[model samples]
Target: MKAKVFIMIMLFVLFLVGCDSEEEVDRKVQDHIMETYGFEVDITYRESLNEGNMGDRIYQVQRKDDPKVEFTVDLMGMWETKIAGDNYEIQEEAFFIGEKFVKKYENELSKLKISNVVFRKSSGLYIETSYNSTISNFKEETLQPLMEFINLLNSYKESEKFEDNYAELDINYSNDKSVQLTQIHEIKTLGQLKEQLYQDLDISNESLKAKDEELFIELENDLRKLGYQYEYGLNSDDPRFESFGCFQEFYENGECNEGYRMYLKGDSLEKDKIFELIQFLNSHSSLIFQDVIISNSKDERIIFEDIKLIKSMADIDTVYSGVNESLGKTILN
Candidate 1:
């Protein structure tokens, strides 16, 4: 009983010491940032790395003055620390101006939701929108230096500085490709640069819709050719049901959060059509459909197959995607 009490007391003392040490580290970091940058800060988060000379502690610092500005700092030695990242990487009031500017033209941005926008000053706007033909043109237009557009956003301050020189378009597709635009500074100024942006976005949205429609038509034709009279893209009253591949209605992860279904054309399922359709559906696994249903013409009473695609735009390899059969979601490689 004496030994147990001693051990518990030692553990409690160690815990208090650990807590005190953490408090000291936090104070040291906070003081170092304030002293160096002349700005108050909040330690957003800290990480303890395995290998470091003075200390393994790393901190993500957020400026009290500029909420958008963030940088990494490494603690070195016993209480010494310095900024290890470009603290001014996102400056020029980019977040302030970008948010303000975008708000002015809220109605213009039909597809480009505010959340999908990342306005990095001097680096142009990074938008996580879908891909289409206009993306190519957007590449051309935006690549010619974002100075023209940045000037428009900055004009409110009556400053004629060309800040934005690059543009990045993140496409949330299964392929997962990013279209970055970098270009030489052009001398000409486009007063209608904002208009051009909206114009390109509109075209892109239209083109994407047309592409989906074309694909739908093609799928129909292909199914008919396979001798399967079927109905594709059914709707449901379930709140969880979502038809995937819609840029207008994308999830936070940038996936088409839509449900899909294909049914036999008539109440009675033809064995040949069912066979062809089942084979096709199994092979038609894609990242777009989060949940899919394959049913007969009768009703939900005859759900032939149910599919769930697990994936995220940030990392695709971490997900398991396949058609489960006989298989109460048979987990197979």
Candidate 2:
């Protein structure tokens, strides 16, 4: 009778365990995600630590349908490492979505794109979150931190006016919402600062405060800011001159994809005097001169290159000269 009682108790415990199995919930959630979101993603967790580092919980993911999609998110959670840096220890819970999981939506998922979100986090926050179809609908403000970082990196990467070396911080909030009242820390290198100057120029060149007294002065300032320097052309007396070198070796979206050329002309003792002439011509719409021919002749006859190219002015000059030679004869008319 005691043996029978023990068997019955063991069967009851097994039945209770079966009822709470997460496998059922996982299957249902996966089905709902595929049907509703039109995408497939696989989720996995990882824990890693080197000798000098604290253990980190990394959530890795892949798009089952798309091989090109993959991303990971690391949770520091009270883990601190002075060698690796200590700026990212969250007292609150934190949640990070791996890049692979986010990539499944690609063009179909508007909110999942790097341009759509911004990620910023503070310490001492508790993090608990899961990805679902709802993630594709995150608002612009909610994704500002991540989006801002992505843009910052992207713009820096592509800007020829800036440097390539930059720091990155990927963060997410566990609370499922962005709160303004939080402390977030960020670190960047001096190279990034220089690159930023280049990008800032693309944003608004009017803000650039360099002496345009010489092209070399502006180019040197831009390159020095980007942790770089350059040499000028060997032919100093040539007809054309390269104005500047790229400050940074990168280029970003809406960047200067094409090369721009500015021409210089006029005989002046000072460079500013030449610049004033160019500025005056630019202010006038009627004046369009590509080349200036300094007439060393004593006649002081100004022959515009365009007038010579079209030859109509040449023909007119010939007709006028012939008329002058004829001296108002009725036969010439």
What TM-score fits each model?
0.36, 0.20
Q: Using lDDT, give the best candidate's number.
A: 1
All candidates: CA RMSD in angstroms? 12.7, 25.5
lDDT string, candidate 2, 1-333, tens digits: 999999999987865654423344335334544664466657554434333443334444444673323434343422231111222222111223223223433453344333333222332322222222111111223344343444443443354232222233323333342222111222243333333333433221211112222543454454344332322231233323333212222224313222212222223213233233324333433323332221112322222222212233343344334443221111121
Worst 10 residues of 1 by lDDT: 311-320
> What tens digits encode model 1's per-residue C-alpha lDDT throughout 1-333?
999999999987865554436567678777776676677777788776333444545677677885556555665543344334334445535555556655664554433322334455434644343332233223444323343333333453344344454355343322343443332132234434323333343334333334455555556566666654434342223324422223334322222345333343434344344444445644654423332333343442223333333222211122212233322121221
Model 1 / residue 131 / CA error / Å: 16
| Top-TM-score structure, candidate number | 1
